[model samples]
Target: MTDDDLIARLEQQERDLLFSRFDFADAWRLGSLLVEMATERGLPVAIDIRRGPQQLFHAALAGSTPDNDAWIERKARVVERFGNSSYLVGRRLAAGGRELDASLGVDPARFAAHGGAFPVRVEAAGVVGVVTVSGLPQAEDHALVVEAIERFR
Candidate 1:
């Protein structure tokens, strides 16, 4: 196969793997998958998950410095607390309303980080949680969560 073809195949394989929704034992499982995908793509990543007030799981890859777990946690908390991601928080705030700042026990400045993170909501179980992936650029982190959510859905 040509180099282009080989690259296409590899990309397809990664996409397929990422799109599969294997059973997540908990938020940790979800975070682990993100790490795996990030590693496969040669992207440094730090991943974390939270369910309600508790941190479900967290990990920083070998090359990743332990930058800030609190920020990752904040992203998750905002998602779970608001039942949506911080992206939504802007709307609520822009409407001339105040949000309770749902970072839970996490620091308020934690949300200032530029990485992507989101809440996990299981309608069947009535459970809400958050998932975050850092280390990559902010858009990439957001894309990771978005892709995972799409796969899970």
Candidate 2:
């Protein structure tokens, strides 16, 4: 599909994935769901859930490495900074014939506009957290997180 088409789908995902409330227990359930899915599929994924600056849940499955953790942080930063799924942000930039760069005021070091990170948006509280996964291909990484959230909420 085209970048615009992908962006539209991601927008719909963000809108549909909203939560009424999110807390530590909710974080545990969501994170655990992702973990179970990965384990069932034997997906070597690292999952992370965060509320603002505080990390709530983290897991590294077999074959997952520290690099996956780093990727999670970068992708989550993209969600926190842009208030959109990391994949959506990247697609929007590409559709505009742009990318992450100094001119865009986005630091590649700290923020990666790649798939894998999704915002944990609470309708009443706005975007209060991020859910991220890494290890698979970028889009699959994104789809994994999205699927978990869709199941959780």
Winner by TM-score: 2
Clashing pairs in 1: 120-129
Candidate 1 structure, TM-score to reference: 0.63
Give stretches of model 2 more than 4 Å off: none
Which 10-residue window of candidate 1 scores lowest in summed lDDT?
13-22
lDDT of 2 by residue, 62-142 (tens): 999999999999999999988999999998988898888788787898889999999999997889999999999989999
For candidate 2, which ten residues in a row score worst on lDDT? 98-107
Q: Look at candidate 1 and tell me the lDDT of residue 115.
A: 38
lDDT of each: 0.58, 0.93
Which residue pairs in candidate 2 collide? Answer: none
User: C-alpha displacement of 33 in model 1, angstroms?
Assistant: 1.6
